[model samples]
Target: MKMLPSKNLLMTLLTAWIALFTSSYFFYWQITFSSQFTHVFVGCLMLLLIGFVYVKNDFVEFEMFNLKEK
Candidate 1:
């Protein structure tokens, strides 16, 4: 079967999206407990780490759902 052209791009984008969601979750929890800026700072750092992982690994593979062979 032929592979889709946008598959890898979609995977990368999904990874970024998930990272954003997770960071936001931390910020949300942080805001309830203490100062907004402090949590946001930590959240930003977490997001950056997530971004690094995606970039360094070059789109992590989900073997179960991936249609194409790596």
Candidate 2:
């Protein structure tokens, strides 16, 4: 029923990009070590990056549901 905030949308896109790259790198490392630790590390890194961006940008709206829980 409503539109997403421009900055929030941009942040979401950037976060997705970050996650995509991180996942790719994780898979690459998985081939080398044949272990899941690196994947977990990459996941943690993605979470940290996303959390930092969200906190810094204050993207408090849910674009899909058009809800503001803040």
Candidate 3:
């Protein structure tokens, strides 16, 4: 009956992650290969983004399977 504590934060994080990867994928597929400097920059940026997201939100995910039928 209650909502998750960080649903919005997770949504925002997922949206940002999708957007960043989409742009990078577009560039990689449509344009030339990215340079090492670009790779380093994006990697650092992604790490910082993930770190910030991790620190700012309380989120966890898991999977469940029910072998017994109801």
Q: What digit string (tens of lDDT, one per residue) describes model 1 on residues 20-48? A: 99988876563454576776889999999
Best of the two (2, 3) by lDDT = 2
Better of 1 and 3 by lDDT: 1
Alpha carbon lDDT of each predicted model: 0.78, 0.77, 0.74
Q: What 10-residue stretch in candidate 1 is worst by lDDT? A: 61-70
8-54: candidate 2 lDDT, tens digit per residue: 89999999999999988876653656356777899999999999989
RMSD of 1: 12.9
Quality of model 1 by C-alpha lDDT: 0.78
In model 2, which regions exceed 4 Å deviation?
1-5, 31-70
Please provide, for model 3 over 1-70, each residue's C-alpha lDDT reduced to its tens digit, 9 standing for 90 to 100. 9777698899999999999999988776644357667888899999999998876554332112232322
RMSD of each: 12.9, 11.8, 12.8
Model 2's number of clashes is: 0
The 10 consecutive residues of candidate 3 with the worst lDDT sum are: 61-70
Ranking by lDDT: 1, 2, 3
